[model samples]
Target: MKAIKVAILDLYDGHPNQGMRGFKEILDRYKAKHNLNLVYQVFDVRGKAEVPDLNFDAYISSGGPGSPVDSEGSVWEQRYWELIDKITACNQQADSVKKHVFFVCHSFQLMCRRLQLGEISLRHSPSFGVLPVHQTALGRQEVIFEGLHDPFYAVDSRSWQVTHPDEDNLKKYGAVLLAIEKERPYVDYPRAMMAIRFNDYFFGTQFHPEANPVGMKAHLINEEKKQQVISEHGERKYDEMIERLEDPGMIRLTQSTMIPNFLDQAILSMQEA
Candidate 1:
């Protein structure tokens, strides 16, 4: 058996914090399972102005707190968009058709905007803790959702989420909405699109399945201002938020199952494509 090379793309390269570290741990665990060669590469999309032409079997775009629509935002780096466009082109091409890309959190925001699956507006913002998503028929059948019953998962902390996943977005992007979590209209956006799959090779999730128990707590305690924001408008109260953040079972399942499940899907997509 040959090792599958994977690149975990981190937008916040130098800052070692909860989001980046959790993604690193996820890559580590997946690499342990098979002949998986994993590389953690950080990039400042603004500084670099583009995504690197790194030759690897798979690419995993890690989560970031920033929005892709911001002029000074993370994925706005020309190279990042270049890579995404290239991957999407590969998906569209008939002759050169082997590519796999996974986007987490804000990374998914970039993908959605580029693919025209959803729009990025500054209307409503989402914050941390365990969110329950109602799984679509496609999500239940997808390999990425394997062994998951409740269809809800806890993500550490994120500032943005999809406001609307209309049919127009879905058709234009060639994406199937996998799951969604309902939210109130005023503070949090309704029709929040939590998960989607363009195909077997390209997948995006609004939730951070990469986060673990330890990391989530560190995030809440560290980002106090963000905590206050969550406290003010988020559905979960402060203590309840923390309790879900540190849920042992969810953490274990995320690490041991969902993360690995994503890696496995990437590997399969690469081999099949």
Candidate 2:
């Protein structure tokens, strides 16, 4: 059995943290379950490294805290555009081979940056919490959602989002809003779309299904609770977060349910192609 060569694009700032580790965990778990030979590598775009051999089944753009569209001289923002352009070219050229792309958080913003639809502005960002997501017709039908239950839960800790892209605009941009929020919507941002599939091979998520319970709490809650933390990070109630993380049933269900389905769909797409 050959291992799936998976390239994980890490665009985080100086220090990479647990959320990044969790994504790798997702890949590791999938490999363990499916007898997959998985080659996972993280590329820190902050330095000089020509895009390594991208001869892989999939390319994943992991979530980061920075906005790729920011004018500030962030090497990551620059690198993102470079990578997307390359990916688009690969899709067009022969012998290059078309591959699947999975974008998380900042990576989603990178897609928007390429399409010129909208950049993630901090206009009305949602505070951290467990957000309920509703699947669109496309989402329900997409391979990423195949065999998954409806109203799937994902970890959303991002501030930037895909802004308003109407149907025509979305089609023009070559993307679709596969999933939306039902309850506890991020009204200000309202999560442009939880998932989008491009050309049947490339897809993205606004939420972090790669996130484990502990990772979720740290990314979603701890970061957002800056105000609370400034006044009372330790003092304020962290019991809810603790309960959510410690709950074996909840954690197991999340891990067992969503990501496996995603991995299966991705691998199937490669086989069928």
Best by TM-score: 1
lDDT of 2 by residue, 1-273 (tens): 767777777766545555678778888888887777877787775444324455666777777775566634565456656766677777676554467677777777677666665545673634344455688887777766665567765556666667565566578857777887554444443446667775556777777767788665665355555446334424333454455556655444555655566666667756765
lDDT of 1 by residue, 169-240 (tens): 687656799887744567543666778897657888887777777766665666774567466766355567
For each of the candidates, the C-alpha root-mean-square deviation to the true structure, in angstroms, is 3.6, 4.0
Residue ranges of candidate 2 with Cα displaced over 4 Å: 47-50, 71-76, 93-97, 123-126, 183-191, 214-240, 246-254, 257-259, 269-273
lDDT of each: 0.67, 0.64
Of candidate 1, the 10-residue stretch with the lowest lDDT total is 45-54
Model 1 TM-score (2 dp) = 0.81
